[model samples]
Target: MAMRRFGVAIVLSVILMAAFAAGLSAAKRGISVGEWLSVPFSDASFAKRWGYGETNGARNVISADRAQQRNGKPTLRLDTNSGFDCWVYFPNTKDWDIDLSKAKVMRGYLRSENKNGWGGDPWIIFVDMAGRKARFDGLKQRLYDAINDWTEIVVPVGADLDAKCAEYGWKAQISPGFDWKHISCVQIHQDTDGSGYTMWYSGFEFIDYAGRTIKWWLSSINKPDLSVTYAEQVPQYKRYIASEPDPNYNIPELVGSAATEKHWPNEGEQIKYLVHIKNAGFARSKPTDFVCMIDGKVVKKASLPALAPHQVTTIVVNWKWKQGPYQFAASVDTKNKLDEITKKNNTLRFKTDAYVLVAVCEKSIVAPIEQVNNWYGSFCFEDWMRGATIDQLNSLFKRCKYDFAPNGAEVSVRLGKIFLVDELPDDGAKIGEIDKGLGLYIFDGVWHYPLRAIHEWCDLANDFDWALNHELSHQLGIIDDYQYDMGPDSNLVNHKAYDRGPGGIMGGGQVGDNVYPAYADVDIAGFNLTKGHRRGFFGEYLYCIPYKNTLVLSIDGRPLADKDIEIYQKSMYTGKIEAPPVFTGKTDAEGRFPLANRPVPKDFTTATGCTLHANPWGYPDVVGRNGLFLIRTQVDGKWYYGFIDIGRFVCEYARGHKDNAVYSVKLMPE
Candidate 1:
């Protein structure tokens, strides 16, 4: 949002701060109304009462002879000889009469016009009854520069007024004995020696004033609303999770007992974590199962079947041991068994190492080629070839090693039809034939074609090398100076000097000397892809199954064909029980490992629900469903499956090597 500027007025009571009992009493009295005097400048009768000065260049001249209409409103034309040097006064003012010591805020409306005014020149002043004056220099006033319409000018009489006056040479004029009483007069003036000037003024007022005190406050129309709002009102499927494991076991230790430093065990590892989940569906969600895994192996899992509609939940998970470089993931299952909705409801992937460490990196960039084409298509080339010979044309092509049929294949030149020729030979072709082949004409030895032909021909890699480099230069908004005769029968050999000296390409005839396109630093930056720093995978393999509710792991989307997935099961809240039934099976040709009903202890109620984990060598770990009444496994350690709340199913793929596998899983409400 752009910043907006606003003006405010504040009123303060000096009597209350004076430390006098009587002063406090005076402050409680509030503001008092002053007299309103009308100074008529329109009626002919009032004009006659005051003697009028010179009708042409007098200051504050009241004329009854020249009144007119402006913008359908009655207006008085006040012409002044000197800039802002106009004032009106009472007929007889020999002594001060009105009191001003109890006045505060003053504001007014003004309109002015200058035939040759540069905008910031001085033009007005205000004077009090004591001969004290406040000068308003247009250059010093902070008025809006874009103000071509009528506007109100406000002047506060409190601390700001005193401060601004001192800073701009107005304080010295109001020193000791400066009596502000009887100062109910206004004046408008201008630079003494400027050109002719005219101005319009009207609508004046004084607001929020109590003797000498002023109060500042914002206008009722300019207040803003402050309220809380959601970052995104609509639900989404994205989820984010952060985790850390104890140093002793590491992230890799959660895969299985046989897990090496590079491939840790899935059981007995501890991890700490948090998860943020967003649901994109409109329907309210019920309790669901959640699971976490490291390197295609399940380390932790949980289940919650009561997530509300469009609600976001953050959950914390703690593991028992340290794990190294692994990916932490979570998901929600609408069904207790492996199915599509379960797979779509929950999932977030992140590198364990990235969470534990911070690093600086760069973004990617690309080039702009369209800008260069428009610049070169504005010139005519026909006149330059008006008197060229066939030999000269062939020689020019030979000099550039321009192959017309190097691969025994004829180049397709669309210019033949436009030039009214049937065909042209590859070499030793007549000048007219050459022109026809190029979709252009060669009168004598110079060749000429429509600008579109250059655009079409330049797109071809073999012939466009130099043409495009030259045309692209023009596209950069640069002008071309290559001269060509617009008239017929011009000499083909006689060329104009382009003045683009030395290695110049387009402008100068030395096209081959500098045949590369010119680019700014921004252009160069677009091609800098090396900044991303690619890393190589170390013995890592990926297994992905697109079907929902099915736990099938594969390498590059290919099932591990006959390879077994190992399964592990335990309580997420407390690790005090023996492993459940061992479920291991090999995958089909599609790399899918399917596991049906496994065993869940009948003795453990909701107080002792269990999670299932699966893992395959070289691939990451996978977690089955959580809060399960039964556990299942397939393809050995490669795939794991389980159910939550007895009906909701969930699964996960483990990631990370053995040495640094850390997994922290959280059980969140739907």
Candidate 2:
């Protein structure tokens, strides 16, 4: 019903183990001082201990179907339409007394079914000697602003009761000199007067004052995100059924599993929005105010009338913001304006873009458009679009779907038309309308955009498509996976935490080779799909080449020039080598080679081992005893062929996939 479902096994097992270790006194884990009674409303034996009946005693429950459940488990359900029903534990009979002196707070899980019943005044009254009652009225406002979601109730009793609550013990309506000791009964009453509502419940117990607080020591995995799998939630599923003991719970229940739809907007264009806010609780929502925020700023505010349980309503908000991706959030009463339970699930988030198409006709690529077409599969369109004609982009974009890479970012950009000089565009004003100028007007390198990519000489740079999508990715909010100079631990793109190596389009060298998006990227795009983690070595290196990190070379102090970086495998003992460059690529800016996992090794291994999944390739971090080396410069260029543990290098430099790390290497000049 909230952010994440817990691993029932871990929680249940831990409790069960603790109970066993504590030498549970044959009382179902009930401890001394206070007991967390498992009064399952469905368990006839337990219900008999604390009898259930209506206020009139004659009102008989027609059927058990009225009993509600969450995620399909039996829960406490009160249908106010039947009449004002009050149930008490250890009633006025005084046969069983609960000592509130030490066993302090009374807690229970509460939620309403009929949202319209929100205004219902629910109370927890503690009855002691002289038939005097001390009502825990502190929950009055909370019940009034209730939603149809489960929330834990912690009301003080006995010494834990504050001065104001103790004063209620001396009121006229209640007998004076109310005593906490020999407390006869505790009653849960809701008077909706036939306004008909429902509140599902679970785990009602009385424990020491120390247990009054609700502690949430949870992991991010328990919080469930786009990357979480159903298999990981098996323990939670099993635990629900065991605790709730509902046959229906045998089938899995889903919550907040809906994917978001992209809302494409235009730059500086005002638009009306109909945002929906849902009440996931049973009692009627006390008068509510809905607030909508965009990019952290409150863009719209509106008041909502009382809403029924599980009801939803839409509010209109006007927005006219600048281009790029936008993060939209709608919160139900962020302020403490309503008396409600938990504020956990009151807010929802969405992602969208405001796109524009523009052209840079400074100098068209000499090669055919086919080369650029291949980049689309590799996802370099954002980096290879520089100096392209508007017509060429039109053809390519027509086949493309709207997507953002580097996975998570809040920005959007539209491809606007770039006008040709004299014809309709220039640095100056023109008759035609151009919303914004794509200032990619200057570049000196020769680009043909052809399949047979050319090299300046013997050194070939992996500069293909870098100027286009690569440059634009920055504007779109995705950072380079390669950090210029950060340490391995601080590498944002490929850190130890990153298990999805060589699988995302956001990565540098390696990403360039594969030109792909990791599963996280797909999720960020709101696509319910997984391509599985792409696994393979760049050659015999046992992993994707130097892709996640950038290597800048300096020969005897200056940027090394006219040298190519070659990687190959060598024997640890014999120093024997495999001929041919496992990978061959030159550098840019004299000696900087930004790599990508490219030429996508033709012979991808089918033997499985690397990850939790049966991946065909070994783990990126495990490169075995076989030594792997990198040649700083080749062919009489002065640098000698040396073996460097590429795996250890990856462990060090290829850390984060969110930022670039430039590792500078100093070599002797030829």
Best by TM-score: 2
Q: Tens-digit lDDT track for model 2 on 170-223?
A: 211334688876665566655554444555455666666476432111111111
Candidate 1 on 547-580: residue-level lDDT in tens?
1233444443444566554444322223111254
Candidate 2 TM-score to native:
0.27
Model 2: which ten-residue window has the lowest total lDDT? 226-235
Model 2 C-alpha lDDT versus the unseen true structure: 0.37
User: Alpha carbon lDDT of residue 189, candidate 2?
Assistant: 57
In model 2, the Cα lDDT at residue 31 comes to 21
On a 0 to 100 scale, what is the lDDT of residue 598 in model 2? Answer: 33
TM per candidate? 0.21, 0.27
- Per-candidate Cα lDDT values, in order, are 0.29, 0.37
Please tell me which predicted candidate would have the highest lDDT against the true structure.
2
**Where is model 2 more than 4 Å wrong at Cα?**
1-264, 295-298, 324-329, 334-341, 349-566, 569-579, 582-670
C-alpha root-mean-square deviation, each candidate: 36.9, 26.9
